[model samples]
Each structure stands twice: as C-alpha cells, then as structure tokens.
Target chain A: MQIVVDLNRCQGYAQCAFLAPQVFELHGEEALMFTPAVPDDQRERVHRAAAACPVQAIVVGERAGPGVR
Target chain B: MQPDTLFQRITDYANRADPYPLYAELRENGVTRQDDGSYLVGTYHEIAALLHDPRISSDYRSRTHPDEAMIRRNERPPSFIGLDDPEHDRLRRIAMRPFGPPHSPGRIDELHGDITRIAEELIDAFRGADRIDIVDEFAYPLPVTVICRLLGVPHEDVPRIRAWTNAIIDSFDFTPGADQEKRQQAGLDARDAMARYLGELAGGRRGHPSEDMLSALVNDAGPEGRLTDVELMATATLLLIAGHETTVNLITNGVLTLLRHPDAHKRLRDEPGLMPRAVEELLRYEPPVHMLPQRTPLADIEVAGVTVPKGAPLILMLASGNRDPLRFDDPDRFDPEREDNQHFGFGSGIHNCFGAPLARLETQIALGALLPYLDDFHLLDDPPPYRRSPLLRGPRHLLIARG
Candidate 1:
C-alpha cells in the first residue's frame, strides 16, 4: 500500500504519527514526514492513521496518488 | 404543536445533568433550525464533516447578529481558536512550538513525572478523610497547578486568574437571561484584565528566557516572527485557561463516571494499562466539553439536507455525536477497550485541543492515582450539580464519600 499526505491540509495534529509512528513522523510543529510505501505489517496501522487524521490529509491505498484529494 | 425547543431544552439548566436524550432527538431530527434562527447539528457524520470544513467559521464575529458583547470583544484581538486560517494557523503553530513536537518534542513528556507527583500529592491530601469534593480538592487544583507551573505564572495568582476565567466562561452561557448584557460586559472586562495580567507576566520574561511557555513565547524569534504584545497576551491567557479549565472537567467527569460504573473502575484498577484507552472512553462517554456554541457558516452549507444560511450560529453537539448510535457500536456503553475511538473530546480539525497531550497525561495519572481509593467511594449525589455553561458541561462539584 502507498500513502499520500496533503501537507498543505495537515495541521500537524500528530494523530497519524501517534497511531502509526513508523509510517508518519512530524519533524517540527507543522512539517509531517511519512513513509509513502507501507510495509505489509504496517498496513493496519497506516489505515488507522489515515482515518484518524484530523484534517483527513492522509490518503492510503491504490488511490493514493499525487495531488489526489 | 409548539416550535421545536430541542436546542433550548438542551441548553436549559434543568437538562444539564444529562442532555443525551435531547441529542438523540436532535440526531433523529437531523439538522435542526431553532426558533432563535440558529442551527444545531447533532449527528456524528454531519458534525464531523462541518468541523473539518473550512466553510465553518469559528469566529463569533461572523454570527448573523453580532451583539454588543461580541463587538466589545472585537476591540481586543481574537485568539487563535476564534480566528480562521492562515491567521489561526500561524498563531497556533507559534503557540505549539513550546508545547509539543517536533519542536520541544519532550515538552509534554517531560511533565509526566511532575504530573504524577502532583496527582499523588493531591491524593495524599485526602488522607484520613471520609469524604471529598473531587472538583474542589483534587480535579481543580491539579490542572491549575500544572498549567501555572508550565506557563510561569506565580502559583499565588491562581485565585485571581480563576476569577477572570470564571467571568469569561460565564459570558458563554447560551440560555437567555435578564443579566445577559451585564454578564457579557463582565466577561469582556475580565478578559481585558486577564490579558493585562498575562502580558505583564510575559513581559517580565521577555529578555531573560525561563523554562515556562510564556518565556519561550515572549523570547521566540522564529521565522514566523514574534507575537505582538496583544497577541502574546491573548495567546498566553488562552494557554493558561485552556490548560486548566477543560482539564478540570475531564478529571472530575472521569472520576464521576468511574464511581458510577464500579465494574469498569475495577477493570481499570486491575489492568492499569487500560488507563489511556479508558481516558479516551471517558472523553467519548462523558467529555469535558459538550458542544461548540460559537461556530458560524461562511457560506450557505447544506447539512443533513438542510441548508444552513451563511453567518447563522452553528452549534456543534460534540458530546451528542460521541453517543450517536450511527457512529459507535453501543454508543452509550462505557467501553474502555473500545477501538476506533476518534472522539471529539479534544475536538478535531484545525482547532483541535492544543493541550490534548498534556490533558491526557494529566487525567490518566490522576485517575490511576485515585483508582485504589475509589473501591470504597460512593457518589454523594448521583446526578451531581452541573456547571452553568452547557457548552463546557461537567459537574461543578462531585461529592464522593467512603462507604
């Protein structure tokens, strides 16, 4: 699975990072860094993170393409 | 049939103890337009969507009928919570720097030992006591001290600061009263006074940096530029109030719920690892904040098939959505181990509770510390007297006694 985070939309609530730290990391207050390609073991965590994103900035699965809403 | 009084009834002091029934009625009614011309959105999905929608404005000035009090408040700069982005975003980010990650990553975590120590100390004061008022002795003081220590405010000033906070919060009462104007003016006056006090406090730390948030904020020279004097005052006051006010309710409400559900309380005490999840459940089951009373729509937005006209007062029933059967399985049940618990306890979207990490840690430690003593604790008042504001609903005092 792949993930796409709309950095513009992300407010760095860090819900994603809290749920899936390995997949998503917040560098500073607002800068969010994430692993785009999810490991099989991390698939569940990534899905949870996406759903838990306060701004809905995280997109996962095959539909996770650049500039995709 | 008379006009729908669901919103009115929900805000009524009589229903303050449990507004869940009215909320269920609201969800059944979908997006409801009250006689007062405001709209109430109670369903889980709709409230969640509106919360995320930028079209929903948090600024009270956007209301269709901006009153004298609101205009008076306008004289002072709006805090980040009341402003829209990029202004809100900017102030919030600057405020976040000293509180949490990635900057000051250990800020909240560093408070763990202090929080535990504080909770234990508060509990220790309960020694040889047959009864306790959780709100007064335990819940209120713990967060107040933690926030004061974090903000660099002298602990001696808490009584004065709390007076200002009370006045400000009392101004938010939704129920129409004869002294509404008086209350509003007092709220504004209190805000100004509090801001002045906070400004002086922050001013003292301007050049010489200290360990507290106010010091960091006043001395900050990040790329975002420093907060103006007014901004610093507003931001500092916001942190101080937000740090303690809601947290007091969270701790009080958590203890109240646990005492009501002894089985859950026992389970929690038996397995302390469930403390975090139990806190989340407490947020969902009996959240500190019950509603967002000041939201306005920037545009005519269709919600649940009803179009909420622009500038109309939009009250989001967060606690209602937490119990919406459509959202959670057995929404009324207090299940600590429940998963997929994305609750509005801290709210969601851009204006989500900034002090959530600290609040969570505080509550968990508080409840964990008090769990052992709760085995013999019984509620002195089942539906305890609630606070005045329905928006920030919780018991004003939770009297518990040893069996």
Candidate 2:
C-alpha cells in the first residue's frame, strides 16, 4: 500500500513515527520522513499509525495517489 | 435530575474519585448544554472529532463571557497552549527545538538513565518504612526533580514553586463558591510570581548556555526568531508547570490503579515487558487530566447533532471519551496488552501533551522500579484523597503500607 503525508498538516506529534518507526521517522522536531510504500510486515503498524495521527495528516491506500502531497 | 447539571455534578468534589458512571450517562446524553452556558461533550467519536476540528479554539479568551481575572492575569499574552495557530504552532515549534527530534533527537532518551536513577533513589528512601504517601514521597518528587534538572532550575526551589503550582491549580476549580474570587486571585498571583521566577531563571541562562531547555530557549537564535521577553516568560512558565504537574498524576494514578488491580499488578511484575503497554492502559483507564475545561468554538459547530453556538465554553470530557464503550471493547477493563489504544490521555491534535515522551518514560521507570515491592503493598486508603481540580485529576495522596 502507498502512503502520503500532508506535511503541511503534520505538526510532527510523532505518533506515526512512534507507532511505525520503520515506516515513519521524524528528522527533526517537525520534519517527518516516511516510506510511501508500506512493507508487508509493517502494514498493520502503518494502519495504526494512520489512525493515531493527531492531525489526520497521513493518507494511505487507494486515496493516497500520486501528486497528493 | 436535570441533564444540564451533568457537567456540574461531574466537577463536584464528591464524584472526584470515580466519575466514570456520570461519564457513561454523559455519553448517553450526547453533546450536552449546561445551565451555565457551557457545553460538555463526553462521547468518544465526538470528542476526538472536536479535538481535530479547527473550529474548536483552545483559547479561553474566545469565550463570550471570558473570566475577568483570567484576562487580567494573561496580560502578558497566553502561552502557546492557550493560543491558536499560526501563533500557537510557531511558539510550540520554537519550544520544541531544544527538547525533541529532529532538532535534538536524543534529548528525552538521554534522560532514561537519569530517570531510572531518580526513580531508584526515591524508592530507596522508602526503605525500613512501614507506610508512605506516594504523592508526597515518590510520585510527586520524581517528575518535579526530572523537570527541574531538564529546565536547569535548582532543585531547592521546588517547595516555593510547588506553592505557586498549587495556587495556580486551585484556580482551575469549576465550582462557583464564595471563595471563587479569592481562589482566582491566588491563582493569578501565583502565575505572575511563577512567571517572574521563571523569567529570572531564563534570563540568567542567556549567553551562559547550559545543557538545559531554559538555557537553549534563552540563547536560541533560529530562523523563527526569539521569543520576546514576555513570550519567553510565558513559555518558560508553561514548560515548568506542564512538565511538573501532569506527570505527578500519571505516576500516582499508575500506583493507585495497580494496587486496586492486583491481578494486573502481578501480570506486570511477572512480565515486565508489558510495562509500556500497561502505562498506556493506565493513561486510558485513569488518565491524569480528565477534561479540557477551557476550549471555545470559533463558529457554530454541530457536535453529536447539537448546534453549539460560537464563543461558548466547550469542556471536552477526555477521561469520559477514554472509557466510551463504543471506542474500546470492554472499555472499563484494564488490559495491559490492549492493542490500537489511541487514547485521549495526552489529548490529540495540535495541543497534544508536549511532555508525553518524558512523562511516559518517567512513569515506566517509576512503576517498573516499584513492581518488585508492589507484591507486599497494601492500600491504606482505597479511595485516596483526590486533588481539587477536576481538569488535572489525580489523587492528592496515595497512602500505602508495605508488609
């Protein structure tokens, strides 16, 4: 599954990173870096991370198409 | 029994120990409008959505009938917690710089050793003691000391700071009584005095540049520019208080809940790996801050099919939402291994608890250290004395005896 983070909306609360550290990593206080393509092993964690995002900044699956940044 | 007084009764000191049943009633009522012109939301989905809603303002000044005492006390501008973005986001970002990732990635993790050591020291003091008050001796001092060291404030100042914090917290009491004015004044006075004290401490850190948050904030010169003297004072005061207050409740509540559920306590002691998840459960089951008492709506918002007008006091019952049956399976049960636990313990959205990482580590260490002794622990008070403020809810003292 593909993932996209609306960086503008992401306040870097790091809930995503905390839940799915392999898929999402916070570079600094506010800069969040993530793996767009979810790995098989991390799919469950990514889903949990998406749900836990405070700002709902993370979009996953079919809705998270290209150019949605 | 008018439904409007639900919020009032919930805040009443009598229900302080266990407000869950009332919360269930509140969830059944949906979004309720109180007689005092405030709105109380207790449902899980509604509270979660409202937390993420931009229409919901955290600023108390936005209320139609803003507290005059609060207005006067906040003459120096409200802290970022009380401000809306882009202002809140800006100040919060600047403040986050020296404390967490990506600016200072290891800041909180680095404190793990210190936190463990501190927890051990506090527990060590309980040696040869037949009984102890966890709040005064263990829970309270642990977080306060950690926060002080992190902020570069001298540990000796805690007693004075504690007075200021107590007065400030007492001001948050929702009940209107004859002493309301006096309590508000004390809170305002405490805030001002605390601000002045914090400001002086930050001022001393300028150019000296110690390895502390206060010094980092004081010496900061990033692209976002510096927090003005007043802003610095407000921010410093916010950090100090926020860092100190809530975590105490988290730790104390953990102990209380553990003692109450001996089975869970035994499970934790046997399988210490569950400590982190247990902490999360404690947050959901018995959170520190029960309600967000000072939120306002920017526009007429439809919450749970109720049209809440703008400028109305919006009290989000966080602890209630934590126990909403619709949100969790067997919501009342304390399951350490519970998965997908996205709790309102630290709240959500932009105003989420800033000190969460540190608070979590501190609690884990604090409780993990106490696990060995909990087997012999006997609660001296089943329903321990709770603090006055319903917002930052927790026992004021948890008395226990060790066999």
Candidate 3:
C-alpha cells in the first residue's frame, strides 16, 4: 500500500501521527515526515489516519492493498 | 416558518443539556437564515465543507458590527485561531513549534506522565468524599493545573485566572438579548490583566529561559517565527484560556455521559484499550462546544442551497453536525467503537482545535482514572446545572454520590 500526505495542505493536526505513529512522524509543528508505503499489516491504521485528517490532506493509494478491489 | 427562532432556542440556556433535537431540526430544514440576517448551517457535510473553505472567514474584522464603538473597544489582536492566512498560518506555525511536530514533536506526548499524574492525584483526592461535584473537584482542577504548568503560570494564581476565565466566558454568551455592557467590560478587563501578567512572564523568559510554552514563545526563534509582545499576549491568553476552559467541559462531560450510560462505562472499564475511540465518541455524542458563531462569510456563500450574503454571521452548529445521520450510522448512539469518527467536537480544518491532542490525552486519562470510582457511583443530580455559555456546553456541577 502507498501513502502520501500533501505537505502543503497538512496543517500539522497530528491526527495521522496519533492514529498511525508507525507510518507517520511529525517534526516540530510544520514538518510532517511519513513513510510513502507500508506493509499490509499497517494498512488499517493508515487508512484510518487518512480519513481522520481534518483537511483530507492524506492520500492513500497508488497501489491497492492485497485482495482490495 | 421561523428558522432563526430555532437558533435562539438552541442558544437558549434552557436547552443546553439536549440541543441535539433542535440541531436535527435545523439539518432537516437545510441552511437557515436567522432573523438577525446571519445564516445557520447544521448539516454534517456542509459544515465540514464550509470549515475547510478558504472563502469563509474566521476574522472578526469581517463581521458587521452591532456597535462600532463596542467592537473597537472589545477587539484585541486576534490569536491565530481567529485570523485568516497567511497571518493565521504564520502565528499558528510559531505556536505549533513548541507544542507539536518537528522541533517539539514529542512535547505533548511527553506530557503523558505529568497529565496522568495530575489525573491520578485528582482522583485520589476524591477518596473520602460521600458526595462530590465533579466540575469543582475532579474535572476542573486537573486541566487547570496542567495548563498552568504548560504556560509557566504559578499554580497559586489559579483563583485569579479562574475569575478572569469566568468573566471572559460570561462575555461570550450567545443567548439573544443577553446583557453585554458590564460583562463585555469585565471580559476586556480580565483579558488586559491576563495579557499584562503573561507578558511579564514571557519577558522573564527572554533572557533566562524556562521549560514552559510561554518561555519557548519568548526565547525560541526560527526563520518564519517570533511573536511581538501584543501577539504574545494574545497568543498566551488564547492558549491559557483555550487549553483549560474547553478541556474542563470535556472531562466533566465525559464523566457525566459515562455515568448516564453504565453499559458503555462498564465496557470502557473492562477494556481500557478502547479509551481513545471512546473519548472520540464522547466528543461526538456530547461535545463541549455546541456552536461557534463567529465565522462570517467573506462573500455571498451558498450552503445547503441557501444563499448567505457577505458580511452576515455564519453560525456553524458543530454539535449539530456531529449528530447528523448523514455523517454517522446510529448517529445519536454512544458506541465506544464508532469508526471513522471525524467529529467536529474539535473544530475541523485550519482552525481545528490545537489543544486536541492534549485534550484527548487528558480526557482519556481522566476517564480512565475516574472509571473505578464511578463503578460504585450514582448520580445525585440528573441533568446537572449547565454553564450559561452556549459555545462551551457542560454541566456546571455534576454531583455524584458513592453508595
């Protein structure tokens, strides 16, 4: 699975970091550092983080998860 | 049909405990223009969309003044929350530096130990009481102490701060025809006094730095940062008030909601891991903030098919959006495991609640620590007395007896 956060739109709410700390890390207040892709194990939380974003700044799919249509 | 009257009723102090039904009605009617010429939006998606829309303005400068003199007298340099970008974005960035990701990434996370300790201490203080006021005893003190410490304010100053907080909150009453002159004056006085004190405190940190957020604001520097004395005063007051005031309601409301619903309470007690999701549900089901009416439309805005003209107030009934059935299944039900709960308990978008992470942590810890005592507790006053402010809604005093 692939994950992306539009750094421009990201206001550093840290909802992503809270929900999926393994996949995303927030540096200071302005910088959001994250893994672009994650193994299937972290898929659920990453998706949850994407949906939880107040700005919808997170994008989660260049590659679909296994068995996901 | 009178759409604006519904807003009046919702803001009415009488309906504070259960304004959800009124909000449902607003959603049903679609976007409503109040008799005051402002607009009220209660639908979930619409509220969410408007919150993110850059066209909408949180700047108070945009509002059509009821009294030009009063607005001028009452207005101070707005904290970033009330400003539009790039100004809002700039101040928020500086404020966020010490509080959140990147530079101080682990700041709030590190407060876990301190906050948990505060919650535990507050709970332990409840050991010998037969009956207790949750607001005065448990919910209020925990956040007050945490915020005081966070801002480098002396804990002994809480009484003074509380007085100011009360006055400020009273000035913010949204009920129609509420007395304004005295309360607004008091609020301005309190704000001035608070700003002066915080300014002095921040000044001290300039040469001799401390570990608190105020210290960071004064001493810390970056390419995009540094707040002037006026900005610092406004920002400090905003943080101090914003940090504790809403959080007190959250903890108080969480306890009240849980005690009302024992099955859910028991579930939370049994599975402590569910605290995060449960806290989110508490926020959705019974949010601290029922309405934020300050956002004015910058231009003619169409919401749910109604046109809200420029310069009119746009009341975003955030609490209403939380219960909108379009947003959540079984919207009114307080399910601890409610998924995809992107609640407006904390306002959404750039203006989303900055203290959300801390607030969530406090509520989680607060509910976790208090759950044991609540296990053997019963409500002494059902539908407890609520505070007068409609913006921040919670029981004024939740009396509970351990039997």
TM-score of chain A, all candidates: 0.88, 0.88, 0.84
B1-403: candidate 3 lDDT, tens digit per residue: 3334877888788888788888889999899877777788998999999998998998877877533433754378878877899999899888877886655656765676898898888778878888889999989999999999988999999999999999988877755454666777788898899999899988988978889999999888877769999999999999999999999999988988898898999998898867877888888899998887778888888887778888888889999999999989999899988866778999888888888877877888888888888877888988899998888888889999988
List each candidate's DockQ score.
Answer: 0.14, 0.14, 0.22
Order the candidates by lDDT, highest first: 2, 1, 3
* Model 2 chain B: lowest-lDDT 10 consecutive positions: B101-110
Better candidate number, 1 or 3, judged by DockQ: 3
Those runs of model 1 whose alpha carbons end farther than 4 Å from true positions after fitting are A1-11, A15-25, A28-69, B1-4
- Stretches off by above 4 angstroms in model 2 are A1-11, A15-24, A28-69, B1-4
Q: Per-residue lDDT tens digits of candidate 1, residues B1-403? A: 3224788788788889988988889899889888879898888999899988999999987888976667788788999999999999899888877876666665765676898898889888996699999999999999999999998999999899889999998887867779888888898999999999999989989899999999999897667888999999889888988899999999999998998888899999899867877888898899988998889999999998899999998989999999999989999999988877878898988889888877877888899899998888799999999888888878989998988
Chain A, candidate 2, TM-score of 0.88
Judging by DockQ against the true structure, name the best candidate: 3
Worst 10 residues of 1 chain A by lDDT: A47-56
Residue pairs in candidate 3 whose N, alpha carbon or C atoms collide under 3 angstroms: A26-B102, A27-B101, A27-B102, A28-B101, A28-B102, A28-B103, A29-B101
TM-score of 1: 0.88
DockQ of 2: 0.14
Per-residue CA lDDT of candidate 2, range B15-57, in tens? Answer: 8999999999999988988887889999889998999899899
